[model samples]
Target: MVLEEAYVDNQHNNLENVAHEMDGLLQFNTDRMIFFRNGMQSALETPLDFMILRKAEQEYISKRHEAIWSVALHNRRTLPVYGVSDAFIDKDPTLSRDNTLSGNELMATLELGYLLRLTNNNRGFTERMLYVSRSGFFVSTESANKHHPGAGAL
Candidate 1:
């Protein structure tokens, strides 16, 4: 079935896809077949099907982040990348940069799921792919875990 609404079950809290990936799963039932038009390369190799689950749901912590990572090596053969860590932090909240917040604290209007690993490069273990379904803005929220001892631990 082509459902544009959120499909909820005891197993899942959010079943509605929040992003329209240039391509994403839409349908694949009985015959279990689905095809989508792509420019040149195909992102989906195997067919995916939804499940009618009835498992119990429990407390789970959710987290997402949108930040750019830049590293510069001394002649491409050094560590720490010399002061790159400073650049990794979000300085301008006016830039509407939301970095360190638990999922519940996040005012995200969309949900993004990613694999545990994306690729490997230059000591970079695994990256992630984020698909923002709708346009949204972020205002960085201060984390209390840094100030108080276990005030708000995720």
Candidate 2:
């Protein structure tokens, strides 16, 4: 099912219908799978040096992006959700020019995903492919967790 709107809300206090909707969106059960599949490549291609910066961005988004939307839950509470863009540029600033190359062509995206051991439920979080400009960066609403199901990495 497709989500008409996407927003994180406090789960515990939320009604059953609202909770069901949130689960669907977070689980990524929509037809937007193609966007996510492509987005994985884009996120992986992000430079290694910038990984820390990217992680910082992810961390920031997890903690503060939707401060008002989340609430405590029973088992843990609410899981973090990240929405990364489809394209990104080298944040080195020293690169001088932009690295707008496709991650598929360069294999940077795949490589990074492997190195980070990221999965759809882990490393780089996204719901759809975003068209990121040169300086564009991701703004996640959740944090990466150690709770991801361990089947594969990257």
Clash statistics: count for each candidate? 0, 9
Cα shift from native, residue 14, model 1 (Å): 53
Model 2 / residue 119 / CA error / Å: 17
Q: Write the per-residue lDDT of candidate 2 for residues 3-34, one digit (tens) a residue.
A: 42333333444677887889888767553455
Report the lDDT tens digits of candidate 1 across residue range 18-127: 33321253332211222112201132332111110000000111112322211211221111100111223345332332334322222121111111111112133224
Quote the lDDT for 117 in model 1: 14
lDDT of each: 0.22, 0.34
RMSD list, candidates in order: 21.1, 19.8
